[model samples]
Structures are given as C-alpha cells and as structure tokens.
Target: MDSIPKKLYHIHRFDSRSGLELYLSGKEDMVFGEDFLKFPMMNLHYVFSRGFICGNLLIDFSIGAFIHHLYSASNIFQDMIIMKFNEKCSMEVRRWHGDRTGAFSWTHTKTSVEELEGKSDETQDKELNLKASIKHIVTCNLEEENLAHPLVLPLADCVISAVLLDVISKDEEDYMRNLEKASNLLKIGGHLILFGLLNTTYMTAGADRFHMMKYDESFVRSALSKLGFVIDYCAVQRRRNVSDLVDYSHVIFIAAHKEK
Candidate 1:
C-alpha cells in the first residue's frame, strides 16, 4: 500500500482576515515578522525608493490579501490594479479598500514603511493615495492564456507578485506557464518584480497546511532567461529565525524586464 498525500488548501480558500491577524499583526508577531513580513517590506521599499521601476500603471497579483508590500508602490505608480485568484482574497482587499467595518488593520505595516522612507506625519495621506490610485481589483486565472481574460485590461508598466507562484503551481512547467501568462499582462520593456520562497515544500496558515513548489535561484534564472526576460537585480535573504508556520529557507526578490 502506498502512503496518501495530505490535502493542503493554503491559498485556494484562504481566510485573509484571520490570516493577517495570525501571521502579521506586526508588533507582537516576532516569529512571523522576522521570517515573512520584514524582509519583503524592507526590500520592496528599497527597490521602489531607487526609482528604477516606476510608470503609469502597476499590476499586483500577490496571493492572499497581503498588501504590506504595496506601501512603497503607492508612491511610484499613478494607477494601480490588483488581481486576485480567489474571491476570498479579492473581497478582503476590497473590504480594506472600501473602509468597511471589520477590515484588517495595516497601520503597523504603514508605520514600518514610513520609517523605512524616513518620512513622518504623512502616513494617512499616503494610505489614502494608495486607495485612490486603485483603479480596479479584478479576478485573474493564472492557468488561462490571458491572465485576466474577457475583460481586457491595458498592459501594465510593471507587475509585482509576492510568494505566489511557489504555492499556486504544482510543478516547474506549471510555474513557467503561469509566468508566461502573467507576462502577457506586461508590456515589452516593462519590468516584472517577483518575491518567492526558496527551497520550501509547504506552508501553514490558519491551521491549514499548503503545498509549495520548491525551486532555487538557478532554476528561476534559467526560466526567466528562456522567457526572454533580462535579469537586472536579484537578491536572496536567508532565513534568520525558526518557525513552524512555513519551511522556506530564503526569500528571493528578482527584478527583470521583458526583452522581447
């Protein structure tokens, strides 16, 4: 008899509201802050602060309702579009965007970004700007030929995703296909920024375990090169703390442009 593989539904039907409280309440979330939130937020601020990837429109396709990484982006892009694979995450973003009751608090993350930018007294204004700049929060299917499909959207100047492809894809080919699908949303010469977990097989959120597609920097570089993306900036941060929530060894951020 063969052993059975456990069912994992990490991102498929995630509870973004509770997930945020559990993993990223920030001030008291030392374990999660060190491994997951801090590095990505800091890196995103650093990347966007350099003014290398700014444009008219920006597309965000990150998993769950995680928008902590978008604080810096609010200053760069004039128009913003967020793509969600599931209704749960989609509604979660909308709830916060609409200022509805029971919305998750991102005040800590906002403060973190303000400190990183060395700015003060304008946090509320910045948050409002991000909210106003959001043109649409549309649904997307990464498996399709056109990521958004039916409702054709203008090609974005940049597409940024965080820790998504790893958990959503079943294999390398699946991952590559999704990459190509997402690439279709980006214009030629536009930039694509990706944040991924390296050498991780599984992750946990709100008592549910999810399967993650594991790959390394070399694999990602080869995939991007084959897809005609010119790799420009790549950074990998090794995990510095221990946690049972996710088993990722490092967080990798790559910035590239579509060459053709």
Candidate 2:
C-alpha cells in the first residue's frame, strides 16, 4: 500500500529522523501530537505542508487566510466572531483573532462560562451582530447524527463539521443522513466544510476506545456533492513527524459551498 505513492514514501522517509519527524509518522498512523505547547510549530508545519509560508510566528495564519478569503468575496468589515464548538485549550483561534479586537464565543464540554469569560475581556473589544460578519464557523462535532442543537446550520453563514461516518455508524446511509442535517443548517448559498480520518481508527486526545469510519477523498467529495455542496477546495494534510513516543498518520480537509 505504501509503495503506490512516491510522495508518501518520501514523507515517511523524512519523518523517520527527528522528534518532529516521528510525530508526522505517528499522525499517518492515527496519533495527534501530544504536546499542545508545540501547537504553534505544528500549525506552522501544517500551513507549510499546505504550500504556504514558513515562519516562527504565533499569529493565527489560518484565520488570516480564511478572513482574506472572506474579504475577497464581500465587503463586510466588522470584526469576525467565531463560535467555536468543542475546542480544547488550543490557541489557534485566539492567535487568529490577535489584538485587532473582536468577539469570540467558545463552547466546550469541559469548561464553564466563567472560565471562558476570563479570556473574553481581551477579545470582546466591540460587538458586531455575530450572524452578520462571520463568514464561517469550523466545528469538530463528530457525533453519530446531526442533532437538534442551537449551533446547527440555521445559525451561521457557514459551518465546518468533522464526522467519522464509517467508524461511528458503519453505514453509508448514516453518513449521508448526518451530512444532510449539516447541509440544512446553511442558507441557500452558505458553505459546509467536512473533514475525516481516511482509513484510520476513531481515536483522539489520547483516547483509543472508539470506532472510526474510513474514507478516501473521492468518497467524501461525492457524498458532499450528493448533498448539494459544490467542491471549492480539497487537500490532504500530511501528518507531521513529532516524536518517536507515538505514531500516527494524515487526514483530509474538504471545503464545499452550497449553490444558489
């Protein structure tokens, strides 16, 4: 299987050397980087792997890219607000917001509003009607079904959800079902971003007790198209080599927009 793609082979070879190399190799096997402190470097590598710039900067380049894309589309200049669901103690979002000032409302299963409030004073410099300026909201909701939640499709301009359809339900219909629910959340011309582990286990955050539905890029793209989402951009993120203590592999990021 590994011999098919020469690029994959080179990635594996380069990943066999240092701690970072080992981390990338492990990502290919299904392990996330353990050290959150290294996320800045990890994110930099992620951007670089996607064919972007290289720098030790801790700014939110991901959000910057997203914002640039959004700005190019329209002229909404109010500060962008992100309603992040299920985000851990990751600084990617905050780093993306930076000191420019904006409102960021975060929701997670493990923390309280007070805890999130402590971090809000610095971010909420001005309040814009959230439903207006936010061009996208990326979520990591890997649930069995798209449930009736306040944060569903009807509430945002765009929603990005990561669902492991195969491992969680083992039925293609189940995957489609959830995908439909996600699509209904958008308006006539909103966007939906979907990502999943390809041919890998259902594991995350140091836990290895769940199931995962494996998928390839073609399968995901077809599924999205069936649900009325036109593919805008799709790419495979090469898992980085972090350290020899663990092993993992890669995942795919797909961006699709609803057609009017």
Candidate 3:
C-alpha cells in the first residue's frame, strides 16, 4: 500500500475550527477554499430542489469541522447525528449547537448558504432550523468496526463524510477499512456523500503536520464500486491558491449509493 509514515504526523492534535476559518476565510489563502464552500452547498441545494430524499437518519462523519455541508444538510434531513474522532472536535460542535459563548462562528458559511439560496434575509431562520435539526453530537472512532462504540446507532439513510478519510487512514487498506465501516452504518440503497483531497499527502494546522493518503478520482470510483456503491455524481476542482497548509492537487466530491 502506498502511503506516508505516521511518525511525522499528529492528526489528533488538528484544530478543526481554525482549519475551517483558514480554508474558508483567509485572505492570503489562494486555495480553492471558496470552491469548497460553494460546490458542495450548491450540489446539496440542487439535490434538495430535485426532491431528493436525504432520509430521516443523516449521519455526518465529518469530525464536525466545517459546518458548511452540515448547515445545508440540516434543512433536508431530521434526526441528524454528528460524530468526531476526538474530544476537541466534539466539544466545539456541542458549543456551537448549544449556542454557548465563543463558539467558532459559522456566519460566513451561513451567509454563503443563504445567498446561494436567494434567501439572504433568512439567516436567523436557517440557524433555528439547523439547531432544531441536529439530534446529537458525539465522539466516534472511524477506525473502529462500529464507529460509535458502546452506543449502537441505527443504520442511516445518508452519511456525509468530508475531509476525513484522507487524514485518518495511513494507507489504501486503512482507507478501505474505514470506508467499509461507514458503509456498514448505512442502510441498503443509502447515499454516501464524500469529500476530500486528491493526490494530497499532508496538511498543516498551525505548526503541527498531519498525513493525508494521496489518491485520485479513479481511486474514488474504484473503491466505492468495490464496496458495492454506485457512483451517482462525481466532480473535482483544481486548487486556486498554493499554500503551505496542504499539498492537495484537486478537491474531489462524490455522491454515491449503496447498491447491494
């Protein structure tokens, strides 16, 4: 299996919120961060508009980092469950959901969602909807056979996993193991919304470095197919800005469904 050495990485020490801010709002950032914000949100909006059912149970395995996708997903699905691999990510999500002070504000994401929907004046309403839609936020181990151990969660209709596998899996085999775990949590014919970096090996959070499994578009399709998922929609965007934070060549998104 082709991969990077884990000895040089510190994935658990990653700051989820700060990373989101840097990727989404940093002026010096030339990366396709804006594309990240727009592409997924727009696709979700189109999915909703087409009367696509996101199902009653929506499991977000995104480690609760950036809420741009979550905020959009909230409106279409009820009983939303978010999971994180570590305590910091879980706590940060709880703070935001609980409306606690000093929560990392997602105002930019909110504004972007609203403007895209042509309902810029409906920010507060959307916030309320999001708050109400989230049923729980908990810690999860993506590497585990059961992501959330000791707490058995019902199979979900849709699972959103973004920017997670790349950083979590040390190799293609580990990536498939984690992906199978996520797939096991989904009901038959359930959808999997995946987002990640393509051909990227590493990322930075402050001074800490982390390993990301480098992979390309074909790998995504082949892996999902091997896992018995039919690729529904797939797209990729090239990076706009070169930054020291990461070395990803393209941003990839895939909408797939379990076929058997």
On lDDT, the candidate that comes out on top is: 1
**Count of steric clashes across candidates, in order:** 0, 26, 1
Residue range 149-232, candidate 1, lDDT tens digits: 878889999999787788788899988987887787899999889999899887766656678888999999999898999987
Residue pairs that clash (backbone atoms under 3 angstroms), model 3: 30-241
**After best superposition, candidate 2 residue 232: deviation in angstroms?**
0.9
Ranking by TM-score: 1, 3, 2
lDDT on C-alpha atoms for all candidate structures: 0.81, 0.39, 0.76
TM-score pick, better of 2 and 3: 3
TM-score of structure candidate 2:
0.45
Residue 232 Cα positional deviation in candidate 3, in Å, after optimal superposition: 1.0
lDDT by residue (1-260, candidate 2, tens digit) is 22222221111112112322222223435244322113222332233334322211111112111222222111222323343322321233443345234323222101221232343453232222222455444443434244433344333455544432433345567668756756765655655655455655333222112344555677788888887778766666655545333223555666566774
Candidate 1 has a TM-score of 0.93
Off by over 4 Å in 2: 1-146, 149-155, 163-168, 204-208, 242-249
User: Between prediction 1 and prediction 2, which has the larger lDDT?
Assistant: 1
